[model samples]
Target: MSKMIKPWIKLIALIIALPILSYISLRVGVIPVGHTDVLALGSDASSQAMIALNDNRIPRTVVALLVGSVLGLAGLLFQLVTRNPLASPDILAVNAGASLAIVLVTLFGFSSIASFTSAALVGAFIAGVIVYLLSANGGNVMYMTLAGASLAALFSSFTQSIIAYEEGALDEVLFWLTGSVAGRSLALVTTLLPWMIVASLCVLLISKELETLSLGDQVARSLGQNVGVIKFVAVTLAVVLSAFGVALAGPIAFVGLLAPHLARYMFGTAFFARLAGSALLGSVLLLSADIFGRLVLFPREVTVGVVLAVIGGAFFIYLVSARQGVFKS
Candidate 1:
């Protein structure tokens, strides 16, 4: 009975938590929006509060969910494809490439989302190709990670250089680099939702292929999977998803790295189960963090990236210490 009910239990728990967290997120800001009071929402007292809720809080929360889900799925894909638990969008330099592109666009005084998103997508694609080429020599995950790290560092340096030289754009660069959701609008949400939905569906549809590929290239090949094509498609989809998230939310860290493993720890090795669970978990983590940030500072909200970086940094260290065996290979 316990065995039979376990999956349902996990699903139910997540289902219960997601809405509750989202509700609490909606209510607990610097200016309180009561769960039951729609009167204030109609009055002049609620004008600024309404604007904050509808424009800033709601969109940021939604973006958190989308960004978290994208990172989780992308991380899962990269890990599966490389058979490396540590492989993620950031590790592949996709985030760095997208970030670099965005920084370049901003440096040139281009603030349009369309321009930034397109540039980021292109940059991410290029980074993925480079990582693929560098790793193809002997399928060495270490070499690939090293090459990606080098590229990330290089791009990061370039981004820093731009911020240093462009005094006028310093504030914009800093805000973007730190990953804020402070002044997001519903229009931004409208612009990015379709892409997130399509990308998520693509990830879901490719889960079986990913599962097959996990068994090893020889096994996947013997099973009639076009190993190369499947890997390419999966990686490309993952990169696009990551790039979109970066363009929208800046380069959020560790949701990708942390979510899939947390899902695996909870749900075992089933790819679809892990994928869905990770998406939910990622959303919960990011939204919860964002909410916590708001409450912690009261009137002054902290950036989501700053909160995640501190948490992710500690979590990453713990993961490294505990999972040395996995990386030793």
Candidate 2:
């Protein structure tokens, strides 16, 4: 009963918070936006505030929302497939792989966001596959995490090496390498929108199979679920979603890890409800981080990625304390 009530309470809070955050995001950028700017948005393209609103703030806000939800959903899928609360796209090298791919392509003069989106998808897919292969030996969560971490480090080092060698390319990939949503336009999202929609629909379609799989392979198989196919499809879609998300906002960390856990806390562990909760909460978390970054150093903006990294660290520490069995060999 308490759990049931809790989800409802959270749902209500999120409903209230989202619009307020969107409005605040519009008003609180480096450029001043006001009631007049909002009214004259389409009528006057020449106004500085209107230009900022049309070109920058709206797109940034949309990117944050879309990236947040996609990462959250992708993280949930990874966690569900691996049965590990700590599994996330970033933690598992998916983000690093995508970043490396984006950097390499940018170095070669393919600097467009659309090109980055395609490269990121391929890179994220390859990295996800390798990490799974390395850890799929029925390894424990710690072992899988280590495997992912090692790959992430290796990929990240290679990325740094390239950046150092080609100093000029550093500027191109800096926001991407560090993970940020700044300067993103809806055009960036437009390139990947079709695929994102398909991936999301596919996830929903197989949700029942996923829920059964959550009970374990034996249970899913007993219920006539094609465990192998389901896992493959689920993982593939997850990688794709994460890839697009990274492309859009560069690897904004921790939303993937934080959102699912937060969702379960709010939605009481039902897979569908948890999924919705994760997406909603992810938007809330990312937007909150972006808002905080805007204000924390007024007139100078901190990247949303940096803000999330700090928040993710504290949350990980809390998880370690609360779930201390992670230390067990």
Candidate 3:
């Protein structure tokens, strides 16, 4: 218990600091809306700034935080189930499923949020089922990863072909594929909030079962746990949460891959501790990236996904090289 205190404190500090950083970054864009302008909301310039802050920056920031946290939670769940740190939504074809669904919808000229959400959910579930079947054959993690990667590659290829044939869909698909919070509306945040909340509750409910399952299937079964049921529930929740995130924010990567590992590094692999810590860390990681994007380019903004990809790619290489045996069970 005493050993856990430091990580919790760090997590708290990150949670508190994220909003402050987001606030500052919100004002630092090329439009030149300062903190004072946000506060005032009186002068004409201030009024426009307020509108931009509320209508643009606020929604994007909120989406980043929510999507990041969701991906982190989903990744943690996947890793625990597979007992592999490399198992993440993106790695396992969950994001690919959602992206394919959205691309199909976009190609058909169906841009409604509801349609996007439904398609993504279906796609993610189907992809997860396929991966599960492939992995469960021999209970082999390597097989699962390979199968997922193949499925993701196939789906991504299909998506690219669709984009190639339809010039009108290029801009929308490109932005989504790269992952961006730019031009996101408040309605997207609203549409995604309830799904996130429900899925989060489900994740919390399964935390104890996940901890037990981590002890091995024989131990879990001996302890009266329904291993199959628990796996289904956890995977379902992860897929749903990840689908909604991809639908709302596009296929943002690495938040899911990195957040849980960071949490474990800080919290020593305890289940609840890693869960909570990763949630906070994920939020901070994403918000910080979004803030950096705002500051670095100023008026012409870059996507948070672009920033994370570069950082995450380098970090992944370092992790794989330094900790080759970390995931061995």
Best by lDDT: 2
* TM-score, candidate number 3: 0.92
lDDT of 2 at 173: 76
Tens digit of lDDT per residue, candidate 1, span 100-215? 88888777878787888888898888888888788888767678778877887888898888888886766866776777656555676688789888988988898898889989
**lDDT (C-alpha, whole model) for all candidates:** 0.80, 0.85, 0.81
Off by over 4 Å in 3: 1-4, 41-46, 297-299, 326-329
The digit string of per-residue lDDT tens for model 3 on 1-329 reads 64757766876777787778677757766666776876764455636678777777777778878888898899888888887767888889999988988888878888788888899998899889888888887667668778888988988898888888886766767777888766777786897898799898888877899889999988999999999999889888889888977887888888888998888888885667788777777777888888887767766778888898888888777866787785453
Residue pairs of candidate 1 with colliding backbone atoms: none
lDDT of 3 at 3: 70
Please report how far candidate 1 places residue 147 from its true position, in Å: 2.3
Better candidate by TM-score, 1 or 2 = 2
lDDT of 2 by residue, 1-329 (tens): 54657665677787688888888888887888997787675785688898888887888888888889889999999999988888999999999999899988988898686787889999999999899899878757887888888999999999999989998757867766777777876777787778877887888888788888999989899899999999989899889989989888887789999999988877876677787777778888898899899999999999899999999989987886899876463
Candidate that would win on TM-score: 2
* Candidate 1 residue 42 C-alpha distance from true site, Å: 9.1
* Ten contiguous residues minimizing lDDT sum, candidate 2: 1-10
Task: Please give each candidate's TM-score.
Answer: 0.92, 0.94, 0.92
